[model samples]
Target: MDTQQNTALTRALAEIPGPLPARGVIHIAIPHTDRFTVVGNHLAQHPDLSCTAVGIAVRIQSLPQGVEVGIKALAARCREGEKRIAAALRELEAFGYLQRVRDRLPSGRTITRTVFCNQPTALLRPRQTASPRRPAVAATHQAPGPAPGPGPAEELTAAPAPAPDPAPDPAPTPPSPSPSPSPSPEPDMPEPPPVPPPPSFVTPLPPLFVPLVPPPTAPKPPPPPLPRPAEPTPELDRAATALLSDLRHHAPQFTLSEADIRHLAPGVAAWLERAAHPDAIRRTLTTDLPHPLRRPALLLKHRLTALLPPPLPGVHDLAAPARPRVTVTPFQTCDGCDRVFRSPTPGHCRDCREHRAHRAHRGDDTRTAAA
Candidate 1:
């Protein structure tokens, strides 16, 4: 087998954000097990979760610890669709293999975090009646950041309570200097070099070009979908009718509406266009079909689509046409020594011509007997 080149895997590995210098790698023992022995075998007992979900769960659990990742990224890594990833995540969470928490930061940004907890589900837990085993899993919680303003002790002494009422000032109060408090420091700061104005003669060009014509102020509504092929073309309609006729002949009990036949016609017409025999398609639809078909027309459509034949040899390649059979040519045999020759008059072959020459030579040599 050719070596597997995981370009997607390599790209994902390259995309993993590196750890900060302040943080070092920490190893936490992750529960690892054969899916067939544990997950697949057990999940198989319940049909709803299907065998596929087990593999998807395993892919999610395979990510490294402490990597902040997104569902899209996980979907890409697992080569699964987003919906499938989401469903698998839900399934794992339901089974106790995952936990999700949503948190809001002080800045009002909300973030969702996922933890892969491989703890066994209650159904998978071993049952022992004797004595309860000490719970292996301990609840984990993050230490809360120091609560906002001040400690209870500091609140008493932090600041004296503001005066209950202040007399109205007659004049507009001067702006407080407390916020800046560093006018002297400003004097010590270095100044920027002044830019000289453009030479007086130079006229500035009109502000570049007028602000690019802002895209049409209003958005254009999406174009309506192309009208569906005018409900099947004439050829398709004809093919559909022909199919119904054939079905009626084979199984007089079968009945189908024009719409149903038209719906299936596209596939049947496609088969004919590809040079599939109409009789074969008809037989497929009408013959020893399964006993309890829910929708025969739809089933026949699927079969036609799936069983499309490979292109015929001359369907393409018109330059070189095929012959049904080899052409025959007439030939005659020599009377002297029955050998076939293309020249009918000189029937004898080249060898027979040489034999005649030898016979003439033999007669010439018998001088006394016949000369």
Candidate 2:
């Protein structure tokens, strides 16, 4: 019944499908005449090995003899990184597909030799024993040569046959002895009672009581002070380097190598960044000459770092506050009211002036009315 059902299912699948969804890899193998390697199915379809490991194994098998199959070499050839390649190699080694043996050569140089196995299971098979050889008489017998004369057949028949009549003698059997009676079974003894487990001797301690107050923690050492933000650009560095190199021309004691100039360029660059003049830097670096001047670089580094001028202050920081201007007018007494007031020149105060103008207007009005 199961076979019938399977047949019906197969027919249905065949009739309804254009092409079934690809469930797994479909291989299109072309036989190779030239550069093909024979890889065992055990390694190609290994259940324990990952895809990467299987690929690496296949590649190693196909490579020509003496070609490097180390992790670095494989990594360089393949797109996978060194770490993944190494991992795949480890997997191959674990599954018996690869083995690395460290051998010391006669020249005392140690090298790692890798062995790739196609059929891993073959490594586990035991060696077969050799078959026994035939007896000496049979081994010595040779085939008959060509007939020597007309009576060759009669001569062959007359030749003595190789002796083979020895037979081995059988050993004599010993006479049968009378059987002894079986010993009686011993009486059963009572089993011992089970022993009680030993009691634990350790005493239980009371729970520890912690204080409510938190213990004082040591203050974190102040975060390391930040390095000065030295803005060393390409231009600044180049200028600084030139200045350092020229120091030897000005002072023979300050002769520095190319390495020293490169190392100390950044330090001198920091001084230039702080609005320090190039002349000032040259003077500072070359002014004081130690008699011996064991290390000119060290001296320059110390001066550059220690005596780096602070950045020039901004306008606000440098400029003093200006006092407001005040004009001092001369003090005057009003002519009409005699009230003291401040004025550019002696004159009546505002109240007195208004009163005099009022009086003059009133007099003008009376004179016009009379006319």
Candidate 3:
């Protein structure tokens, strides 16, 4: 495959987000092609194969290329018994979905590695037998090539004499007499009437089709346009890529994609447009990160978003809410009514406030009652 097509296919396959590092996207993702699907489907639906076997084959196919998945590992991953996994592996191998190769390590240790070809191919498998050889051509004996010259004649040539013939005839004998004819039988009393022909059968009408339930049909939508992978500006690409690379260096286990970088490019671009130093942005993103982060891209994105500067000050719109002004004020608590109020005059609350008129009225009322 050409570079562009292969890259696009890889990205599409990688879209299936994997479990561990990614959806089996290590440094590169395995291309999911028809061949892979065919092998998986064969194992899944073949009557002789059990569901456990199908599940094992499918999970192995799901793994990325270069993954070291052994029978034990597979059993653990699939939650199947080790023996079951071994049997499934054998079945897969027998069915051509798997192949085992013995590779000798540098230390001379030979270990068997599996190669899986999921295509439904009819391979010309060879056998140990002698090849039938071609038949030997029959030898042709040429009749003695025409005698040199006609030769060899007899001594005398005498004319042969003819012989005469003689014969005679005889008389005939009388024929024997014929027997007399027998009497004829009497005719039947009355002849029977001829039988009428049967009536012709009419053609039958075809049966009208009636279904138990209406066939379900869904409205089909117009075909969606083929995906055109976005091409980001070179500078944005470099910045985003560099950030992801640095993060990887900090945390090796972290998995990130070019798509993720492109997705976060706008935020990075926003920071860049606001005259934020690229170094400052990088420093802010990489700073104070947890040791083992589940998703580094998410954390980086959040930091970049927080670091983004707001648009420069502009003339306020009339419809927009105005910004409130701020002024410092002292708070004091009223002695009579233990209520705190912010103001210049704050002896007490107005209702429980200290006033001269109410005190005199209270004293006169008390004195009148006493007299």
Candidate 4:
């Protein structure tokens, strides 16, 4: 009974044929009401970010505050090793999704602070050069000068001539010699020289908003055109189309529809016009068909276009030295039969010559008989 059941199962499996269809990722989303962390599409769908980096980012965002999220900590929590975790963290930092800063505490200990941003674009920080201290200007000091002496007017008021005696003195008092003028105050110290402004030390800052994606580079050059025959004709086109349609008969793998045949006909026509044999074209299109062949017309079109042969060579293309032209034989009339024939010089026709030879042989026979 077990043997019979096994045979039945084998037969059932044999009935199913052909390759299985390719499977692709399919999302079966279930909306979460609570205990879910909201992640922006910028980090989730970043083109440059790797899958590991995105996963690490999501995990870091979901965790509560005060949790150790360093490389070793993450490696312990997740299956990845420390090296991969560190690499992912670097990727996150580069794209502005995460930032790690070494902060110093009041107690003189330094610790790393990891900052995760859900929306890097909205909270993106601009990169700026550090601000340097401005240069100091030296102070200018001038030597002090002597103070100005009392002016002539102040001296007159300060020492009023001994008040004139109420009664006129009998003898004029010898006029006191006028006090010598006080020495002129020394020249005012020369004004101090002006000081120049300090040189600018602060570097100019780049644009405030940092782009999450790197700046675009120049576009690449377009590819060269595909090979093809120089000139095409209606007959060539028809023949090419027929060949393409008939491909399915010889090789079932290249079963193309009418639309595909029409589309690929021009490329085939190019191959045909280049003197490629029909059998060669068929073999080329059918040879080594890929297993589970899909889009046979596309494959045939590519081969036809890319593998087209060069045009047949002309007489001038020969490598040998040029040869002299052969002289044409002129038409001639046979001397005996007057039949027209071509020859370099006048001569009897072939039939007339053969008749003469036969008559000469018969005469010799007659002569021998008579003797």
Q: TM-score for each prediction?
A: 0.27, 0.30, 0.23, 0.36
Q: Which tens-of-lDDT digit does each residue in 161-275 have in candidate 1?
A: 7877867777987887667554432223344455454334433333211222222223577633211223456876587568765686677645777777666666676666666
By lDDT rank, best first, the candidates go 4, 2, 3, 1
Q: Where does model 1 exceed 4 Å of error?
A: 1-233, 315-371
lDDT by residue (tens digit), candidate 4, 95-156: 77777777999999999898777776654344454455445544354466899999989987
Each prediction's whole-model lDDT (CA): 0.62, 0.76, 0.63, 0.78
lDDT of 2 by residue, 1-371 (tens): 44446676566667653676679753434468987778877887777677888889889988988999998899889988998888788777666677788899999999999888777666565545444544333223345588777587788779688998898986888987979888865555555555554544544433222223221232456533212336657888888889999998889888898888887887777777777788898999898678888988878777777777888899999899998999899899988889999999998999988989999999999999999
Least well predicted 10-residue stretch by lDDT in candidate 1: 207-216
Indicate the TM-score of model 1: 0.27
Best by lDDT: 4
> What C-alpha lDDT, on a 0 to 100 scale, does residue 267 get in candidate 2?
76
Ranking by TM-score: 4, 2, 1, 3
The number of clashing residue pairs in each candidate reads 0, 0, 2, 0
